[model samples]
Target: MDNLSRRDFLKASGFIAAAFALWRCTPREVTASVQPAPTPAPTLATPLSADDATTLTRTLRRITFGPLPNEVARARAIGLEAFILEQLNPESIPEPDILAPFDFETLEMNAGELLRVDPPGRPIGELMGATLARAVFSPRQLYEKMVVFWSDHFNIYIRKGIERALKPVDDRLVIRPHALGRFHDLLSASAHSPAMLYYLDNASSTKEKPNENYARELLELHTLGVDGGYTHQDIVEVARALTGWSITRPRRFFGGGGEFVFRPRLHDTGPKTILGQSFPAGQGVEDGEQLLDLLSHHPSTARFISTKLVRRFVADEPPEDLVTRATQTFQETDGDIAEVMRTILTSDELRASLGGKLKRPFEYLVSALRQTQAEIEPNRALFRYLTMMGQPLFHWPTPDGYPDVAAAWMGTGSLLARWNFALALAFNTIPGVRVDWDVLAGEASAPEGALDTLSDRFLGAPLPEEARSLILDFLNTLDAGFVLPALGALLLASPYFQYH
Candidate 1:
């Protein structure tokens, strides 16, 4: 996973080969030649053999944010096992027109937008809107999800004004392009992204005034484990090595290229040691590149990153053996993400841990959108919902970003916010998203029937009879119109529905 070796691998194998080669092997079922047309949509209720359930769960969680009605049907038609393989190999999947609704060029805004007529109204809102729109409406669901995953990994704060606007571009360029590619390239790209540079203060970091914020988090959060055996001196050395890497001012530079520019004058010429390895001295930005290489290939990084992937898709506390296996794959494959994913997807650990991890706020938002067949017009609602859930888009306050642990999400206030969100989403109270109330209502009879249909629509199966009865009882005292959305919301917020 060293930079030189990873780049060499890319050069030797081509980008496609680099991506696939880095992926650890997955034991996938042979794809049936007769793939089904994309219609009638897939669902969990579709009779799956016991063997298919494990594959189906992985496909639903990883292939896209969550499976919409049509997507679910397509999975059933193609066979769940084949669908998982296709998602893992996204390059083979033709680029789908998911961003059609988003005007990526004009929609972009940074601090410059603040100087406009309405200074108080920031274009950051619009930037977030475009992002959410793409996530919910775009056909390239897997890419969108990976973008989200990497965003959290290299979390930046959008509240930083103009600089925050660059994250979308960074996502498209730095993160998305190599999401499933080699982990080393991805690490280097994130390090050099204008968004990361500015957000972490690398833009202002100088030899005399080294900013350790990005450096510390880069090790603690981005690459090596929080418990990685690095010291304060190591962090300071890493920061010193990164001094002089700044972004071109949008207004001052080459027509807003807004890219990272290395200033040798601002860089530290003094030799430094990071992770116990000393650079001979006199290297400038290349020193930082070398540092990233060292960190990317570190044994701590492999285990740390692998455990995170497991947490995202498998279980809260993934098995030690699985993590070891994934870490081994990461090392052997030179940080190939697809290869690491192949290892996890094909393992007994993940298969046994399926349905154990609670879906995060962003995951919940995407899943709700998928289940209800909601149409995204502006995409502001998705961003708004994410904010309401305390996970605003590109707005993590610290360089360390949002937490992955369940404790960060639980509590009375957080639970209340989630309940309110669930209700609003189902009732169509949120702006820019539409749901078919009539179609939902027509599926069932009494309030219980309505509840049952809602369970199927949002939860992927019929409601538990007791849960159905409880919802029906709640509905008896309310209007039917109110009943359906309320029940729909309740199911979405259900404990059972929280985990994938």
Candidate 2:
């Protein structure tokens, strides 16, 4: 069993090619007639059926990294509406001390303190580790998912100079605190972040020479969509309004740097117009604050943010009606993130979107770790696999962050990397990560029984009879000792596991 090669494993699971073909050609039922719940409650509007149960499981998969068995039972017990409410208010959920195993000093440090760490890159590494740890182990699953979403939405590359030191602060103060709060507050916090200012060269912007990097992204990526009505002059004026939003530079020892500071001397101090609104002259920091307020509450921002949320939770191409409704929720609630998410999550669109979205590399890795109940130490060894899969946390060089579409991730190299990871994890070859195969297998000792059990555990449903027959036939060829790991790896790498 220990000596089994990957080639042998693949050969045994020869039905993979056919499974993939069926997955591509088969049409899914992506239309449901369910109505949105007006509010979160403990009751359902209708009786739950097998299809409804499957839809709830798929919905859980969409919101969380992946649903553990206990989570699935809890959702079934309380119903999806109540579950959504509980997740929306994450303060109600008591989180396990998942970070106790990792001794990362940087999680608590301010940017000024982070700059002085002995090894320069240690802080970034610890940040990535803690992020993965939370995704895999946190009880507040939906809150963590929003953290990932907003992290991508307001991305700052960690490799940039001094940003390596500043981003941990941004992740702590700017992103996490307001991830589920109001959009205006989150936008304002990001506008004032030292990490963002440094990453986008806003710290060096001045009245004489304003940098448009942050301003351009603020319009195109952050708030307004690319097609959102804005001319080149709008970006220029926004940049001018944001001038003098800089980070402090320590002059003497312990003077303290890496804090956001407004410098009136560097500000434009003149009138500016943006998006058809004018700012009167002589305003200092209020200009940027006003700009954030305008952008966050803009109708375009509502539509743009709503589209991205639907794409994340519903489908690659978002449903138009859901987007419109979510936009209305955003505007009506004054950009309340939790209410907007409620609108999206409780909608029939999400239920109809079952198996419609593909899991990105990071989601795939985390889901695997979760489904297997893998004990992890959260270190570089695990991150190495993510790098191989092309989604190393905080490593995207561009401000747009990682791609969210299936086409961007369904390449040969990416799929191969996923297969290799499945093999490594099932064989217990990854350092600082281990899966107890016997416990995962439960009472199913025979190969046929083990296949059904593991399929339900991993995919939330049993495999089709033909596919099950093919896998069991292959398992018959393997030695008794090699059956469980091979079966587990085959299921993980299967096409069914590729989507939520």
The alpha-carbon deviation from the true structure for residue 267 of candidate 2, after best TM-score superposition, in angstroms, is: 0.3
**Quick one: best lDDT, which candidate?**
2
| Per-residue lDDT over 1-500 for candidate 1, one digit per residue giving the tens place of the 0 to 100 score | 11224433333223222212212121122122112212211112221123564356444755577676666777788876576667777777676566565555434443233234143334565567667766777666766777777888888777676654576567667877898889899999988888888888888999989999888889999998779899988988989999998887765222355678999999998889888898868898789888999999999999999988876666555677888999999999999998888888767765554444556787777777777777656655556667778777777787766776555776556655666666666666677767876786685767766766666555555544544555555557555546565566666766546655
- Look at candidate 1 and tell me the lDDT of residue 419: 61
Compared with the true structure, all predictions reach lDDT values of 0.68, 0.83
Model 2, 1-500: lDDT tens per residue?
23446765564455345335434433443333322222211111221224767778767878898899989999999999999999999999988798898898888887777778879789999999999999999989999999999999999999988887789989999999998999999999999999999899999999999999999999999999899999999999999999999999722346257889999999998999999999999999999989998999999999999999887887777778999999999999999999999999999778765665678889999999999999988878788889988999998989998888776786777877888788778878788889999999999999988998888888777776655776787778777877887788778877667676
List candidate 2 stretches off by more than 4 Å. 1-50, 250-255
RMSD of each: 13.9, 5.3
Error of 2 at 357 (Å): 0.7
Q: Number of the top candidate by TM-score?
A: 2
Please identify model 1 stretches exceeding 4 Å from their true place.
1-63, 102-122, 252-254, 379-382, 441-443, 446-450, 476-483
Give the Cα error of residue 317 in candidate 1, in Å: 1.8
Total clashing pairs for each candidate:
9, 0
